[model samples]
Target: MAATPEGYMSGFGNDFETEALPGALPVGQNSPQRCAYGLYAEQLSGSPFTAPRGLNERSWLYRLRPSVRHTGRFDKVDLPHWKSAPCIVEHDRPIGQYRWSPVPIPDASLTFVAGVRTMTTAGDVNTQTGMSTHLYFVTASMFDDYFYNADGELLIAPQQGALAFVTEFGRIGIAPGEICVIPRGVKFRVELVAGAARGYMCENYGAKFTLPNRGPIGANCLANARDFKTPVAAFEDREATSRMTVKWCGKFYACEIGHSPLDVVAWHGNYAPYKYDLRAFSPIGAILFDHPDPSIFSVLTAPSGEEGTANVDFVIFPERWQVAEHSFRPPWYHMNIMSEFMGLIYGQYDAKPQGFTPGAMSLHNCMLPHGPDAQAFARASQARLEPEKLTKTLAFMFETRFPQRLTDYAATLETLQEDYADCWAGLEKRFNGKP
Candidate 1:
């Protein structure tokens, strides 16, 4: 796909090289004392210097100015609805299972950063573990402003409208059913592509999101690396006053700059922003008898240092075939160790078919018993055994090992469905103990 100043290269975490102008990049070494275009050489590290080669992520940038000039005296900024973790007692409401209707966009104009409303937060932001879920209702773009979150990387999922992300690396255009991830400390601005946009952002404070291991399933299917699109180098040398907002240690700080932070004329690195089309995800599922675990649908996972236990797992349930004979095609009723924050991009989710409309969200914390509501259970139980196709649906989940605590804004939102648990009321005792 095309972008404002550059195009995209296909790969996930590859050491890519790009230059907006010829010979802007270094010939051999990363830093050659003097850059080709009279630019400054800088290194951006996403991981530690001693990190393993596979895990090490750093980029060399040739910019018009060093990043040292991109800041001023930071002042505290208040983002009332943007919350972080460790403050568990946001409200006194009892939490069993919760769901919300589509949140209405506000009447007041809101920029991308101002539009963020935290729904749930897990783990500790200061400790750099766990993640948070946010609903963004954007009425305006960040004009003459940029934002970078030192707390975590942002995984954006557009549910309603399109968005154009102009980052230090390059520009990315994403629409519904497409997702893009901006690294933790990358400076970027958001612009509305098709008017006001609404989306979900999973702020991952743990390890950066990476493709899950296929293991026994082998390496061929499910979110192939070749499908990921990373933008090429692009920049502007124009001078203008701008505002920079930094989210560090659960607080916001504002900085003033004289020029765009995205003035990287050329870059070579494996640490940059990338986008992926959810439609291109090759899903692997239960082929014959039983319903497979939701891990099969994981598109990306941020590990929490434990084997097979992720700080956050980005899972999607897209259009696919249901052919499991002698089994409940919908998800079975069972409590899980991991907390789940779910959202519907479009169409009907197979579990909670009604009330869970597009842009709606639900939360089932760790060990919370939740599955198909009575309607879905009954429908799947009585349906024919023939293979059926589920079309035009895209539902996703941010499953985490840590329990997600509801934020005050989310706990008392007008969109919160007070009687969401009532959907399971119709699930009468169907067990007569008959073999």
Candidate 2:
């Protein structure tokens, strides 16, 4: 809410307090009987009230008008391409590894919500137990329209251009190598900062994403708390006709509103949107021998009800040094219980060095063996083990415990590489009885 737009408060999940106006935020109290500056006090809860202290999340907002006044009678709207979980569409393609070239940014205008093309989904949205992977091709910004998702929180990784998210909390600007997460039920509008924007989005329907535990690796070396930025208080106070859309229960509903919903003048709480730059992540790898499991590269993990297993893990392969000695390097062949939907943000992914371009995507479902392409395998096996830096490359994955099912739109997209499996075709059998 500060006059300095896009300013952020540092730290992850800290009870941040900010105000656009002096004394707008109450002192020593969350809600006062009489609010200051004639603003209304509202509570935004991200978790159940009785949830554990560490897990509970809630925010108190001082706004020009209460949120209830921001909407009218709702009507159903159609966003055909934005599919949700439990959306198993019939397809002819068999189960195996799949990859796609960049989904082209269309000439026609498309906003963030309008351009969402769901590629894969897992678990059930109704039960809030799964996630969805989507590619967004944004050509235009939302002017007088705003949207909020009731089904799940959104994690966005931009690959092509830049975006400015004006939310109820504040503004977060992200570019090709960064990500932002908008919490469930947070009203926000996406504005294109560059000509056109392309990105990968993950809709997490389970628990909110949290920094993964380091365990034996000790207290630091991954995503430090200070690097996860939450925007300061900022809001819009315009009076004009606007439309608000809600994605609830995997369906779309729209309502007419008299004014913009981004009117929070001040707020104090941990339940808000935040962003992270992939460049800041401190990656740890095997130094003496073989590489660690990909889980070692996890940036954030949304845990399931079970212990240890994750509902969704946001992992990244960023610019780093590869120095393992006598190791196969570049990810070794293996099958995972979790499904992986990976995308490149900027540079070449070391695994599929040939076709996995920036803005491209690859999907490997549960128990499906996948690893470096034939060329990558041959090159890594022959190259000398030294401290080599993988510069300017940023790739990421939305790995989930549930199997990812392809949407009809994705299954038949022309960009989907039909011969994706051929990347491994050149692998020669190297088994030797003498060895």
TM-score of each: 0.98, 0.98
Instruction: Itemize residue pairs with steric clashes in candidate 1.
Output: none
* Candidate 2: segments with Cα more than 4 A from true spot: 1-4
lDDT of 1 by residue, 1-435 (tens): 222464899999899999888999999899998788699999999999999999999999898889888879999999988999875873878968999999988888999999999999999999999999999988998888999999999999999899999998999999999999999999999999878889899999999999999999997988999999999888977578999999999999998888888899899999999999999999888888999999999999999888999999999999999988899999999998999999999999888889999999999999989999999998998999898999999999999999999988988888999999999999887789899
The lDDT of each candidate is: 0.92, 0.92
User: For candidate 2, what is the total of clashing residue pairs?
Assistant: 3
Report the C-alpha displacement of residue 87, candidate 2, in angstroms: 0.4
Check candidate 2 and list the clashing pairs.
Answer: 1-20, 1-233, 1-234
- Model 1's C-alpha root-mean-square deviation from the true structure amounts to 1.6
